[model samples]
Target chain A: MTSGLFHVPLWIELVAAATGGIQGALFAAGIRDRRIDVLGVVAIGLTVALGGSLMRDVVLDQLPVVVSSEWYLLVAAAASLLGMALQSVLTRTEWLISLLDAAVMGIFGAIGASKAVAYGAGSLGAVLVGVVAAVGGGVLRDLMANRPISIIHVGTLNAAAAGIGASMLVLLLRIDVPVGIAGPISAVATALLRIAAVHLG
Target chain B: MTSGLFHVPLWIELVAAATGGIQGALFAAGIRDRRIDVLGVVAIGLTVALGGSLMRDVVLDQLPVVVSSEWYLLVAAAASLLGMALQSVLTRTEWLISLLDAAVMGIFGAIGASKAVAYGAGSLGAVLVGVVAAVGGGVLRDLMANRPISIIHVGTLNAAAAGIGASMLVLLLRIDVPVGIAGPISAVATALLRIAAVHLG
Candidate 1:
């Protein structure tokens, strides 16, 4: 099946969506404790999913992928809805959110870097954009939800994880790996690194 | 006279700084009402000054102007400090806050568009970046302070003001107005348009 043939890339993006959703849900839930509403939650969710890419595109002087790619919006929204629906499930699996958060942060960073390279920017520029894209969404999400951002917090290896993932993705893409495949690999690297750091740090 | 030699541009930027500070203060004050602390207010002030320019730079793959230029950070901090200090004095005059907000918003937007043009992007891209630069700061400020963003609010002329200012600024740039002179002229146009909009709209 054509779907089967594209399964790897598709699955990776979906996983990204799921992770992003969970992150958004956590943000919303945190704010809900302070009495923020449903609309605010959705905005935070959507922003966390697309904010970095939007910022990336704005910086690059390109048409915003957030506005241009319909899939981006759909997948992000679907993922957040899944998060909202599974709130009870997440509560029981406390460790899962952290794992997913790490993974999502990594993949988004990798994708941002890889895409920047594909667009013909320098490797260094790609790396910087990657990190920004990775962490940026979460930053916006937290801000909107009225929570302190995760990046600036002590003992959080967010930038470290994003840097490693983005660097790996850019290197892989530079060497000519199909980013569709290499992208997920970098995401995993990012997630695993974050997890390791989370435990170690 | 020292005042005469001080020139119009210096006075305008000072006015701009005071205006921007009040708006930043208002947003930070609102966030404080919701229980965020001192760091939250500082972050919001920075966001109001730098968010748009940073957004524009990151997308363009350049080091953000906020980081590269002393003026951006200095002005933002000064405005924020001014705002924090005068919050009580200005709070009673809500109309003053509204007017200052309108003026600062307009000026920033014009500055963004002009900067984008200087960066060698296309006209349309410049216009978009300009608008982003103008409003990006305030939107980020609101989000950081945990308040409602004006961009998504109904019947808000936020973007419209920036768009018009951007168009004018971009148009003037195309005619080759010196970059230094263009910034203040465009800022004035934006400020006037915003003031007009408040009365007319």
Candidate 2:
């Protein structure tokens, strides 16, 4: 267990990981100009699924849960492979890709913020960690692919949406709200903002 | 003290950080085509100076010395700013840049391997950490600049030289060599190898 006071349910965390893997794989596959091989694509997918967790644990000075737990790696790898297989069929479904991306960002952001709160970080610090965790993997992906960092280059509200979600979670925890209630609210809010931005544009 | 068994001297670590800062700033400034602002150049400089140490500490599941020690940040930032100021004068001194780059990699690699050994990692694991610590910052810099990763694309012996240095340190430690002696030897060996590759090429 991560902590006695706060922990995301295993199934919920797994779902988030799975979606992250799929979304990352699909995103990597969409980059056709680069000479990214199959293995490269899969690696990017795994980064999306686990890189943020590794970064979060490292920043907190703890062993990464991704490395310690066998299930996370196995699930992420499987989901990444599954995503690769499905990419051809889903190539045209841009909305679905956007939805998964937003959902993954939101879920990861909330989890990161909640963990920071449990670790007793100040509100701003917790929110910072949450935003990093939300966007770290995408940054890594862009780096590996030699592409511009999406959060920095795109005028989209990706990081702002994550910041809002993370801030909300931190605020909720400050008032003694249970993590269970606050976490989902944070995730949904972030996802909606992101989705709204994309749809409106 | 990082550990009772082994630790790099504060002065030695500072020198490495300073060199890394200088090298990183020079490297960033050389990319004239990119629209990197002054702050961007300095941030990249800081990344090269501290990113590897951050990665190494995170992998070892310990708090980053770069964060905990005031000296590291101060020295790195000052060195980065100094490097930026000297860029115009040093623009033609390509050899100096390469030398600093090699030396920084070697020093960081040796320190990382030595720390992992002190932390009771296996030989391979220690060496892996060393290579990552040596090359991690450069990778991040390239990523930020939207360039192909230098270590991966350059076909140089950068990673190999670092691996050789780290492995040598691990071997010396296994035979009960004092870290004080082993560390410098490792650093020198890595630097020479890298320098040879550049000159010979």
Candidate 3:
């Protein structure tokens, strides 16, 4: 019911959705053993793109932004198709995919935390919501694709990056910092941490 | 926000949650390859018991009842522990587990549809919400357990059963039938269909 709680620029949100969709589609398409059809690939991609926002809205007791906004689905679907088309090229460059994935997660985390704060959720709840929003889509995607959840598995520190970024944003907000300034800073920090974890491992 | 929308006896809801918790724990404990700890089993069981309700509340833009009500979590946790203790005995009886799962899905579907109707959702949305509520927990459980989602895979008619029951409940509610009668009838129909599907297969 509450609109505009996602105070970020529309273009930034679109970029995040596109990034998530592409990564999710690529992940789905790369699964050789499972027989996920074309529709399933698109569904998984949309889940990744829109799922975080949906979960965040639901947690804040608002209508899911993805369901209420037509553009969100359109952008996600388009990006999913593009990702499917480019799966061959995208799969070869693992580093690029990981980098993009981390950035997207950070964006989602910042947005989710900001919205939760706007809704008057406590600091701890906001951080948890942000982490859930960052990783919730991948959880849904992995479930649908019949693969291990990337966040929980002994891989990169996906959740840790989201948590740290969200906590930083919350702390900055408490200090009267503009969301515009805090959001990108948090996102970049998360991206750097995630990239470091992946490279170091 | 809407407290009494469930409209079911407290005992019935407790029974449904207990059944789901036991079945979920048994399922988790039976996974031969997965290294799920006792805590994981408890978590999965709680997800199965309370996930549907949490999802339903979120979709309806209401505060999740699970988080709001201490009783919900307490009952779910207690039932989960009971399931864990009985896992060895329960795993040996597959038919019993399937029966309980079907019944739990039915109860959740009925409760969800009824609540959606009470909350003023359209009939189609109510049915969809009901099915999601019935299966959402299992999807979460499967994702956490790193297993294939049972609803989407080509196996039992899990979502189908929930959808059918939810639709029936909505239709009955439209005819001015009380939720008490409509809910049980729909649940029984779902359970019967599920049981028949299992036996015939």
| Candidate 1 residue spans exceeding 4 A from truth | A1-18, A31-33, A88-90, B1-137, B143-201
Candidate 3: give the clashing pairs: A1-A63
Which residue window of length 10 is worst by lDDT in model 1 chain B? Answer: B1-10
Report the C-alpha lDDT of model 3 over B1-201, residue by residue, as the tens digit.
122445556667677778888878877877779688999889889989998888887887887777876677788889888888887654385776688788888888888888887776667667767877887888888777876776644333666678789989989888888788898999998888877767664
Give the per-prediction TM-score of chain B.
0.78, 0.94, 0.92
lDDT of 1 by residue, B1-201 (tens): 011111124344444545666577666765434875666666666666566667666654566656765675677787777666676565464566667767777676765565555555566656767766677777776666545666433214555677777877777767877656666677777777777766765
Docking class of 3: incorrect
What value does DockQ give for candidate 3?
A: 0.18
**Model 2: docking quality category:** incorrect
TM-score of candidate 2 against the unseen true structure:
0.63
iRMSD (1 decimal) for each model: 7.0, 5.1, 4.6
Listed in order, each prediction's TM-score against the native is 0.55, 0.63, 0.62
Instruction: Find the candidate with the highest lDDT and give its number.
Output: 2
- In terms of TM-score, the best-performing candidate is 2
Angstrom error at residue A123, model 3: 7.4
TM-score of chain A of each: 0.83, 0.93, 0.92
**Which of the predicted structures, 1 or 2, would earn the higher TM-score when compared with the native?**
2
> What is the C-alpha lDDT profile of model 2 across A1-201, one tens digit per residue?
123556556677677779888988888888889777899879988989887777777786766778887788889999889878878876485676788889988988998888876765556657766877887777777777777876644523677788889989988877878888889999999999888867664
